[model samples]
Target: MIKLANYTQGQWQEGTGPGTTLYDPVLGTALASVDAGGLDMAACYDWARTQGGTALRALSYAERAALLKQIGQVLQDNRDKYYDISLQNSGTVQNDTAVDVDGAIYTLSYYAKLGGKLPAHVHLEGESQGLARDNAFASQHIEVPARGVALLINAFNFPSWGLWEKAAPALLSGVPIVVKPASATAWLTHEMVKDVIEANILPAGALSIVCGRPEGLLDALNALDMVSFTGSADTAASLRGHRRIQHDGVRFNAETDSVNSALLGPDDSDAAADLLVREVVRELTIKSGQKCTAIRRIFVPESRYEAIAGAIAAKLKTITVGDPRKPEVRMGSLVSRQQHEAILAGIAQLSHHCEILFNGSTEITIQAEAGSACVAPMLFGAKDPDTNPLVHQVEVFGPVATLMPYRDTEHAFELVRRGMGSLVASVYSEDPQFMAQAAIRLAESHGRVHLVNTEVAKVQTGHGNAMPQSNHGGPGRAGGGEELGGLRALKFYHRTAAIQASPDILNRLIQNAE
Candidate 1:
């Protein structure tokens, strides 16, 4: 069994408390145990602020991005090992692991790309003003990294990608990072962080990890400390209201799960409709539909409800469920029995509010190995998109999607908005006008909206997923916050101030800023 270690101040340390067992999703068998208790939280914070922050800020954006690229490459080279460790966390097949581990490495490469495209200064370009006859001054702006620490509180799903998506930008913008991965899957992140350390890709004190509960850590934070949290809305609200954070104006960003939705193209042919059905089943079965961006609500025209339901149900029936490693299995198990229970509870809630169209009937047909818990993809039907109460209010967080029928494009927009706010909402249409109208209105409520049709559907990102380049999180029930939108995320770790000064003075200030 491989034991996970925490990277603190450039050193690897063993814990004093007993470890928790990490398991394989297939049979719920123990793969490894990771220790999480008896670490000095205060020291961890101080080390980050003093050593990590200072050292990181000393490097330029290009320099920091370079280090990140190295880390990304190193991880890419060792992805096989990463895939092995990832399967232990469950719902992780080869493709899923590639997206999680390799995707993070790619995130660094993207950041490096972003650095070249954006400005080097802290402010953006402002309107030009005339200084004198034949003499004019233009105000170009730039963003500076916050002279503080970035507390990255990541989710259990997509642990590596989630942490890297934020950490890459935070580091590029010159902020030290203190990562707190979800306790359920910290080991994978730990392994990646270890590879980074072994490769000597980052300066000492630039990164640190906390393996367990971060009790009282937020209370000790200063104004310079900023936090980026990805998880439940309730938990994000609680963290945002921490006494010191609220009073001292600490930066806070949250990416919470919500009822993400997708709309089918009205003019799509039977073949196009078949593609959409397959897409739905793929999203529903991948990671056992545990992704936060996964489509929880699907909208179709009322006239086509039966056709859509039949097409989707047929594909859902074909999904294989079992160990992710099995070549025949298309979907893996949920992370744990506790997570399975939560998914079942959410499904029960949906049943109370909506009619069950597809109950993942096929998932039960597959025999579960001893001690394993599993659920096949389930699809529900809500006949009226505008009137269905359960469609927007409930999200099973499993491979379940509620089909809601709309009267027209306007009604589709209304149903999409019924989610209140979402991390993402997808539209499938070929007409430019329809796509534009649906997307514009949906954008008002959704953080990221993907317009998918025949041309883009083949290469289209599925309905329920947010990439590193796009903003994740939305207003209201989707945690009412945002994270990882390129350089925008860097601002989460920085403090901005407006300055009025002459060229010489501004130049002097810029030179001394870091």
Candidate 2:
């Protein structure tokens, strides 16, 4: 079997130790060994900052954007190979794989095009503010590249999209990146990076990857470095409190696990009911509910609880689970056997507070081998969500959700807030007045709220889709970081400085001063 290697210092190096074997999620067979032993983390950072950072910083925004566009085009041409790898490792169907592979290319291309419209150098903040009574002195803010490297620690669910999304913004800001993908699904990420490097898509040190254990990497970082992580809450908390982040002042941003909720308004119209049911089902089954933004707590009007729950359960039954290579399988396996077991454990904990509305069996009839990592979709109904703390606290990061009934619109809002904070939420209502009222309350807790109605329902991007142009992070338990809101993401890699001086001096300092 092939061994996954690390790309650093302008060369690919194999791990020194005997690494752990990676398994094909669908077939339960060993695919490759992953290791990052004996690699010099300090040298990797030095190379990226000197070689990669120098090359990227020397170019104008427009020129850098052109490079991104070229990379996107190359990846698009070779998408089929990525799809096959995604299937074998991630166990995702073609549609699911497209979300990762195609999404990555689109994000890069979008950023490339956006960069072309921007100025060549430091992004000026608002108009200069007059400081003196005579208006002779003024101050202005300008953002410049941080002159450091970005270390990206990604989750297992989205090996492609996760890397490219962060990379696009960092590169645009003239910062290089070093990615450490989750060990479980590093194969797909490794292959993608390998292709990009071979094609000369990026500068020699602009991008690098280290698979297997992330030992010595964190200690190698200094205050000048920035880290963006997406994973579990515990891991995010630990990383946040790391000595380097706490004392060294390294920038750290996290997108952690959240119990995102979806609320159905008190309106009993058939149109609203249909939209709610469809969205709930889609959020549950998409990528087998491995999404951080997937709906976990579902709130409905007390009178319409049975109708909504029954509709969702009936729709979920029609989904087929098996190997992603098969045409009939609508839902595929989890990322690996370890993830399967974790989901089962989460479901067991959730079952303590909520009754199983629809329990998919572990004994599944699948097209793949008998030991494939496949789990059935599970739905739990909490009779009193307010009383059942576990239903609100525990998150089963799979095709599982908890349904709860609310007494009124106010009660629905309260129940949704029980999740503390979330990445996204959806409010289904035909009445514009009710939606407007409920949305105001829901906005306090959710980063993004989907207002679903008959008119926009046809074109709506559903609940779990985090678009490139919008912000993707949330506050409180959701990690309290902002990402990908147009040019906002670029600010993460840049530092803002205020310049105060006389008009002529200010004019000389601020390029393109109005």
Candidate 3:
């Protein structure tokens, strides 16, 4: 089998030590072996700072943006190759793979176009403010590149989109990047990076990939460096407490998993009921419910609990679980055997507090061979979710969700808050007042909330989809950071400084002297 290589110091080097084998989730066939034992940690950082940082910082925003546009075109022209690889490694159908491949291309192009409109200099000057009573002294905030490398630790669920989304802003801000993709799905990311490097679209060291264990990378960071992570909360906590991070004052941004929820209001119209059922099922089955923004908890009015549950259960029964390569399959296997077993354990724990409304099954019939890691969709309903701590706190991280009944609008708000904080939430209501009130209440705990009604339901983007134009992170358990909110994401890689001086001095410093 081929071994995955690490791209560091502008070269591809094979790993040392015994490596772990990666398998195809749909075929149970070995794909590659990954290890990072032979790589030099300090040299990698030094190369990025000296070689990569110098090349990127020398270019103006417009010049860098043009480079990004060329890269985007190259990736778009070869998207089919990425889709084929994703189907084998990720166990996703064409549609699911498009979410990663197409999403990445769009983000790169968006940043390319936006960067041209910005100022040529690396620093951006805010509106000047007069400080003295006679308006003699003025101050302004200026944003400039941090002049350090960005370390990106990505999740396995989106190998392509995850890397590009973070890389776009970092490159746009004139900062280089070192990517550490999750080991399981690193092949796709590795392939994409290889394409970019071969095309010579980026500077020699501007972008690099470390496919295996990120053993000593963290120790090499300094105070000026920035780290962005996406994974479990446990991993986030461990990284946040690293001694080097504290000593160097590295900027750390994390986006972790949370039990995101969706609310069904008291509206009993067929429009509301149909929209609610359709959206719930869609979120549960898409990407096998591995999305960080997927709905893990469902809150409904006491009177409509049974009706909503029945409607969702009926819709789920029609879905076919099998290998994504087969055209008839609606849902594919989990990413790997380990993830499949983890989801099974989570279901067992949740079953203690709730009754199984639709236990699709532990066994499944699939078009692929028997070794594939496939599991049926499972749905549990809790009569008194407000009292069940597990229902409110535990996240299955797969095709599973808990349905609970709420007393009223206040009760719904309380249940939603129990999630601590989430990346996204949804409310299905036709009543204008109820929708407005619920949105305000839920906004306190969620980064984004989707309000669906009869007129907008047909065109609405579902709850699990994170757009490039909106902020994707949330507060509390979801990780207190913001990402991809237009130009806001670029600020993470830049530092802001306030400059106070006379009007003439300020004008000269800003390079706008009249």
Candidate 4:
């Protein structure tokens, strides 16, 4: 098996000893292994800050954007080669792998184009303020790169998109990056980084990846560095409590899993129901519902819960689950045996409070020889959502979702808010007033409120897709972080400072920024 190596100090480096084996969820074959035993974390961080960070900081935002474009092109050229690696390491079908691979290239390209609109390094926040009585003295707020490394600890799902989405803005903001991908599916991430490195598009230390155990990963970072994590809430809490995060002033951003919801409007039309059902099944099957924004708790009006549930079930039954290499298999296995076990345990936990609306567990028929990780889609129903806290509290990260009933508008909002916070909450309705009110109510806790009707049913990107134009994080249990809304994503990697001087001097500073 190929041993995954960490890229640091301007070269590919491997661990000192044997490490964890990465397996194909289907067929249970060992694809690769990773270990970080011998690598020097502090040295890697220092190399990035001094080499990559310095090289990047010397260039203008536009130049950095050009670098991003080059990197994207390289990935696009090698795109076909990544599919087999993804199938082996991630257990995802071609389409799902495209969601991760193609999506990353798209985001990088988007940022490359978006950076053309920005100034060299100084972005004036607003108009200058007259600090003194006379107009001669003025102060202006400007945003600049933070002069640090963007360290990312990503989850198993979307290894490609997760890294690029965070890296695009960070690199555009003139911050170098050190990525620590989850070991279970680091092959695709590793291969992508390797391709970019081999193409020699980035400056030395501009991008780095450390696979296997993150033993001294956080410890290597200091006050100048920032971290963006995507994983569970418990893991976010642990990272937040780290000394570097709490005491040394290391900036941190998190996109943790949450019990996300989808609410149906009180006066739902047939068109609205049809859209909701399709989106629901798509969320469940795509990437096997391992998405951070996947709909976990679905809330429907009590009057139409039965009808909607049946429709969703019938649609889900059509999904083909098996090996991703086959053309007919739409849904694939979980990433690992550990993930499969966790998914089962999560299903068992949710089953206590919900009745099975449709159980596809027994219907999963693999087209190839596979292991026990293959699981079919399963749907559950909650008769009363307000009382059952577990349904809102637990997030079963798999191709599983629960349908719940809410009495009315107020009850629906209450049920959704019970989730505390979510990345996205989709509302299917055509009523202008109800849609408006739903947006207002749901936005209180959700990062994005997807309002759907027949008008844009065909055009609206599915609820789980985190488009580059919008924010992709939420408050409370969702980690209270924001990412990927056009240029706003650069904010996390930038530092703002107010410069006080004469108006003419400030104008010259802006003019001479490059």
Candidate 5:
């Protein structure tokens, strides 16, 4: 079996404790073993703060962007090898794996674009007063790199893109990175990290990885350190409120799974309905509905409840469940047995609040099949929104969606808002006026809104996933944190300080560059 090791301090380090066995979902056989026992968290932090940060700061913004482009090119050169490893990580098809593998490279490429487009200098100038007392002060703003380490805690789904989104900005900002990928599919991330090391794109100690758990890792952080996490609200809360993190004033940013919803416009034609069905089905089956941004609740007119579910259910039925490497397969298995159990448990919680409409329960009959865990599409019908608030409160992280109906457009927006806060909400409409009204009303409650219809539907990223260019988080129970909004991510990596003084003092400070 292939053994997984941690990449730290410019070398691969062996684990000190028990190892976790990695497997293939299609074959149910051992592929590798990852050891993550006795990692030196303190030393890891020291290396990033010193060696990593120093090298990155030496380069200018344009120079840094150039390095990122080189890294992207290197990733493209070895894309096939990364895709090969992605196939075994519960990805049921090549398209699914390619999105994760290539999407990461694209994210870095986008960062290079951002660096070239954004202004290098920000000038804060005071307005000139009347005649002889024409006193004006000039303050030049310089976008400098954060002089510390960045700690990234990513989710299991989209492991490659999840970590790459954060790494691109951190490195570009002249900060080093120490990543902690989700344990479920750390091997794939490990492989990608190996390529990053071999390419010599990043300086030694600029990027590091710890495959498994690193206990007491946060305690060693300093004021300049940053923490970016993407996961569930419960886990986010525990990490965001850590004793050491709070005491040391370490920055923390989180993107938690929320009750993301989608809507069908009032003037939507039959074509709109058909488009909605396709989008919904894609959200439910892609990554087995394991995405944090997956549509958990769907809002529609009371008259079209059965029609929407029936159309979507048919598409779900056609999805093939087998090895992700097979070209014929459209959907893949969940990441692991433990994740399968968690999704089922979440489904049970929803069942208590809503009735099952379409049960996608089936056993795998393909080769190397292990029937120990299997989940097909599950559609829940929540007829009444007021009867139980739990329907909007809980989420079944699988190929499932709860269909909720409303009397009119106003009622639809209200029901959508009742989910507390969400990461995203989408409305499909051919009418521009209706789309405008719905988007304006729902925009406050959701971090993202896809005002999609036949016009932009062809290129839509769909309703269930967040791209690296946009913010992928929400407010309230949806964790009320943000991540991946271009350079907004850098806000979490560095500390912002405001200095109040005369122009001469500021000039002296800038001129005395130590």
Candidate 6:
């Protein structure tokens, strides 16, 4: 079996004894195994803070950013390898895998280009302040990288993109990071990290990947350490209660479960309904609807409910489910058998609250192993969203979405907000007033309010796409943290301070070689 090892302290360190074996989601065949046993967590951290940290701190922001550019090139050159790994490990087709692989490269490149314009080690928050009437002393508020390391705990879906989105900002801001990828789909992440390490594009201990179990990972963190996690809310809650997080004040950022939504506006045009149908189908089929930002609840005007619901169901019918290796297949299996079972149970429970609009056939389009976890997209409708709390409360986390009829714009807003907090809420319509009102109202509960009109429908990034320029996290049940708002993400890995000094000293602190 192929064994994946952890990279830290400037070497590839393999774990001890037998490890957990990973399986092919399509054929149920053993692919590889990974272990996280008998490793020195404390030593791994010290290497990062002392060796990698010092190396990065010595460079200017522009200099550090150039390293990101080099890292992006390494991934770009090895893109096909990642795609093959995604098909075997993630059960994703070429199009689905591109989102994770290409998206990661794009994020890294963006930060690299953006960093070329930033100052060296210091970021002045505001203008200098006068401390004495004699002008002998002054103060300047500035921001700089924190001295401790950053720990990234990623989710099973989008393993490649998840690693880069968090790592890019942390590295650009001059902080070293250690990544712990979700065990089920870690091969793609491991390969990408391995390539960067072998290329020697980064300093020693600058980036590390710890595969398999994450026991004692949190305990190794100090108060100055930072953590960015992407996973379930239950796990987020449990991690928050860790003594280091609760008492020692380790900075924690989480992007957890979100029942994202899409609303068709007051306009009842066939064009509008068709646009809504196309986008919803794409969201469900893309990544097999495993995205945290995927639209789970869909709202439409009561008058156009029948027309819109029928259109969406018809589109979902065209989705081809089978092994991604088949050129004809448009959708593939879930990431693993355990996830497949969880989604099946979730579907059964959600069936109680809504009527089936479309129930996809279980028969695979292409011949495959009987145990392949393939599933086609399913659609449902809830007449009374308020009465059915499960439609909003329980996120199925698969190729499933619910349609709910709304009396008017206000009712639509109320039903969508009932989800508590979501990563994004999409408004589709040609009606300007309705779109504007919806964006305003939905902004209360969503991190992003995407307004899609006929003019924008052609060019708007779909509801599920998380752009690097826009912030990606949400409030409340979505974990109330932030990530990937251009260079704004740098703030999370940095510390702000006000330096009180003389005028000459304050001016000299602004840039390198000042």
Q: What is the lDDT of candidate 4?
A: 0.89
lDDT of 2 at 505: 81
TM-score of each: 0.92, 0.98, 0.97, 0.98, 0.92, 0.97
Q: What is residue 16's positional error in candidate 3, in angstroms?
A: 1.3
User: Which of candidates 5 and 6 is the stronger one according to lDDT?
Assistant: 6
**Stretch of 10 with least lDDT, candidate 5:** 121-130
lDDT of 1 by residue, 1-514 (tens): 6667766656777666777777776666676666656667667777887887787777666677777778778888888888888887765778777768877877888887776554444534343344545433323244567777788898888888888888888888778888888877877888888778788777778888877664566876787788888888778888878886788988888878799887876765565566667767877977788888888888887778888998887777777777776787767778777788888888877777677777675335654575565777788887755556767877777788988888877777887888888888877766777878887788889899887767776687666656667787788888777777776666666665555445665566555533
lDDT of 5 by residue, 429-504 (tens): 7889998998799888888888888888778887865677787778887777777788776556544444445666
What total of clashing residue pairs does each candidate reach? Answer: 12, 0, 0, 0, 2, 0
Superposed model 5: Cα runs more than 4 Å off:
118-143, 362-368, 499-514
lDDT of 2 by residue, 432-507 (tens): 9998887788888878888999989889887988888888988778888777877989999999989898988878
Candidate 3 lDDT (Cα, whole model)? Answer: 0.86
Q: Residue 305 of candidate 4: its Cα lDDT?
A: 88
By TM-score, rank the candidates, best first. Answer: 4, 2, 3, 6, 1, 5
Clash pairs of candidate 3?
Answer: none
lDDT of each: 0.75, 0.88, 0.86, 0.89, 0.77, 0.89
Question: What order do you get sorting by lDDT, best first?
Answer: 4, 6, 2, 3, 5, 1
The most accurate candidate by lDDT is 4
Over 81-177, each residue of candidate 3 has an lDDT whose tens digit, in order, gives 9998888888988878888899899999999988888887646455889999876998888888878889999998999999999999899889999
Superposition error at 508 for model 6 (Å): 2.8
Show model 3 residue runs off by greater than 4 Å.
123-125, 362-364, 512-514
Error of 1 at 222 (Å): 1.0
Candidate 2 residue pairs in clash (backbone atoms < 3 Å): none
